[model samples]
Target: MARPTKFQPSYCDQVIEHMTEGASLTSFAAEIGVARSTINEWMEAHPDFAHSVRIAKAKCAAWWEKRGRELAVAGGGNPALVMFGLKNMGADDWHETQRVEQKTTLEAVDPLSALLTQIAEGGRRITDRA
Candidate 1:
């Protein structure tokens, strides 16, 4: 018969919360009054624990990325509008929708306006003082 381990439910919950909050295994172990090696063993023994954290982190990142995309679209990517969305950011914020209206090659503007616009747009929000 297999021996029952002393892995308590509270301990497991603590581990999961710590990991989801971006703590390292060693840090988590320390936070919960356990040895780093012991926590590592638990992670190895309970593959689900590690998998859950990986999925959670990926989901969080995807959500943030998607939010940026939505904001970009909602602002119509106008420099003023985007800036408004970015500035005074509480539930909403920005700058003068800094993006070019769209991807189009027009002789009225520079031939490579579209390309340069694309490159410039890529520079948006690179420095997040917000």
Candidate 2:
């Protein structure tokens, strides 16, 4: 048998209110006396909860961005730390440059050698054409 759920419809509003202050979903879960995974499960089971969570996420990012902007304009606090926080908290809006690398390998094989090697090595190539 499964345990009873602690989810309530009002939690949707609570999540948005909590995240509006730049709080994380994890923190919200902690405040509500639930694990983070429970939040994910609730979102999956309840569409309204999922929508509320989405809005809450955006609000959280906006809150972080607001702080970052305030610090940038005031020039009173550690700009680097604020930038780091924004990059981490508002990753969708603030992100560092990223580099991606792709590699391709080309191999040449003679058809006859490949066929003969395949026969000799039980359907496997023995050497590459050079």
Q: Cα lDDT for residue 70, model 1?
A: 71
Best by lDDT: 2
TM-scores for all candidates: the values are 0.33, 0.73
lDDT of 1 by residue, 1-130 (tens): 9766545556655655655543455666687677877756666777766565455444434444445677667854345543333342322322245566677776675748765676587765435424
Q: Which sections of candidate 2 miss by over 4 Å?
A: 100-130
What TM-score should be assigned to candidate 1?
Answer: 0.33
Candidate 1 regions exceeding 4 Å error are 1-4, 53-130
lDDT of 2 by residue, 10-105 (tens): 999999999999888999999999999999999999999999999999998888788888887886877787777678778887998879999999
Q: For candidate 2, what is the TM-score?
A: 0.73
**Which whole-number lDDT from 0 to 100 does residue 74 have in model 2?**
83
